[model samples]
Target: MATTVGVVVFPGTNCEMDAVTAVEGLGGSGRLLWHGDDDLSGVDAVVVPGGFAHGDYLRPGAIARFSPMMGAVARFAADGGPVVGICNGFQVLTEAGLLPGALQKNRGLKFLCQPATLRVETTASALTGRASVGDELSVPINHFEGNYTCDDETLARLRDEDRIVLRYVDNPNGSMDDIAAVCNEGRNVVGLMPHPERACDELLGSADGAILMASLLAAA
Candidate 1:
């Protein structure tokens, strides 16, 4: 059966199309999910695409977390469905409490857009199934609040639990432990600050990002 991946789109979400394109390109059916919809009925997996939701007002995803669709997202995740959050979507996951750690403003306090190198640290999760631990790949990131910050104890616990899924090779955003992506306790949900969907089209640059999305299809 073909896998159906739902790409949630909110106002100002610029990467929804890219995410949908990437999912369909990899032989999965891509479906658009609106923020107001409460049903995620037939989706095998979910993708929260990047963008400045709610105009990034009052904190990046603060307002978006309360959207009607988040209720469904939370239920879907609790039921063991896979969810991937890219860039702004990552911020939303954190705000929605689906993932831990809060994304803060970049240390330099600027909106940064550039390609970054990252090392896959855990392949045990569904999101990293196509990637082996220690594999390095380049992906693009564009955001102002991409810096990942959690309390010392939370950081320690994440490290101890091996939940840190991706680490920045060059540490662009001043994230603690160079964390670029992370997984939930169940390991079925992942949130990353980079634009992996943007990297899936080789014509744009590199295909490294395809592996992460492909991994989800494989798991589905």
Candidate 2:
């Protein structure tokens, strides 16, 4: 059977179509799911694409965290289903408590858009399985609240468990530990500040973003 991937589109979310295109480009069927839908009927995987959900109101992803679709997303991840969140989606995941830490404003306090180099930090995550640890790849990041922050204990625990999946080599946003992406304890849920879907094609720039989506599809 063909894999059916669900990409949740919330109001004000601008990357739904881009993420759908990336998913279809990888030979999977991309299904658009609304934020109010409670059912993830045929989805083998779920994606939360980047955008200013709720117009970045009340914090980057704060309001979107309470959306109806998030309940389903929470259940999906808890059941070991693969879920990937990019940029604003990453913010949503953190707010949803699916991923640890918070994405704060950039240390420079500017909205950035540039190709960033990140080191693949783990092989067990569904998002970074295709890349070996220490391997570096470029992905684009465009956001003001891209800085990752967490308490010392949580940071240490994440490192101890190898839950950190992607680390920015250049640390573009002053994120603690240079962390870019991290997975849950099961390694099935991933959230990162970079817009991987935006980098899926060479026409857009680079294909490095496709690696993570490919890894997610393969996991499905």
Candidate 3:
């Protein structure tokens, strides 16, 4: 059977459908899981797509972290299931303490919505396992607070562990170390500022995201 990927849907999440469609297009089954629902329904993987969760009140992902569904996600991730967060979903992962670092406002304090070039830094994680290190991908990013930051110790550890999965070729958000994506210690959970789902189709400008999504499915 095809892998069943669960797309978490918060109140302000507008990209759940996109994520679901992308999963289905990749030959996986996609299911929408409501933020208020705690059940994962035995999904093989979980994806938290972009959009202002809880309207980004009190900072992005702050309020959304308390949603009932997050608890279940936490448990699912703790069991080493694959979880990928995109854009605002990346913020939520950090807020939920599933991933490290924090996403801040853009350097110019302006929202960014454009294509970005990212270099695959590691394929050890579930999200990028299908890619080779140094492989470049063209993906889209749409967010106002996508600047990633972390403490010196955390940065050192991430580097030492090869947990930094992706980096921007041309820094767009002033993120520390030009980081575009990162994975948890287990390598099962990953968070990134770019929207891979938006780049899954060639007609949408690029199909580079297919490689990443395929890796997730295989890992699941």
Q: TM-score ranking from best to worst?
A: 3, 1, 2
**For residues 86-110, could you state the per-residue lDDT of candidate 3 as single tens digits?**
9999999999999999999998878
| Predictions in order: lDDT | 0.91, 0.91, 0.94
Q: What TM-score, over all chains together, does every model reach?
A: 0.98, 0.98, 0.99
Global Cα lDDT for candidate 3: 0.94
Error of 3 at 143 (Å): 0.9
Q: Deviation in angstroms for 50 in model 1?
A: 0.3
TM-score of model number 2: 0.98
List ranges where model 3 is wrong by over 4 Å: none
> Which candidate wins on lDDT?
3
lDDT of 1: 0.91
Q: How well is each residue in 1-220 modelled by candidate 1, as lDDT tens digits?
A: 7899999988888998899889899999999999999889989999989999999999888999898988899999998899999999999999999999999989886789999999999997768999999999899989889999999998988899999999999999899999999999999999999988889977979889999999988876
The CA lDDT at 85 in model 3 is 95
Off by over 4 Å in 1: none
Highest TM-score scorer: 3
Residue pair clashes in candidate 2: none
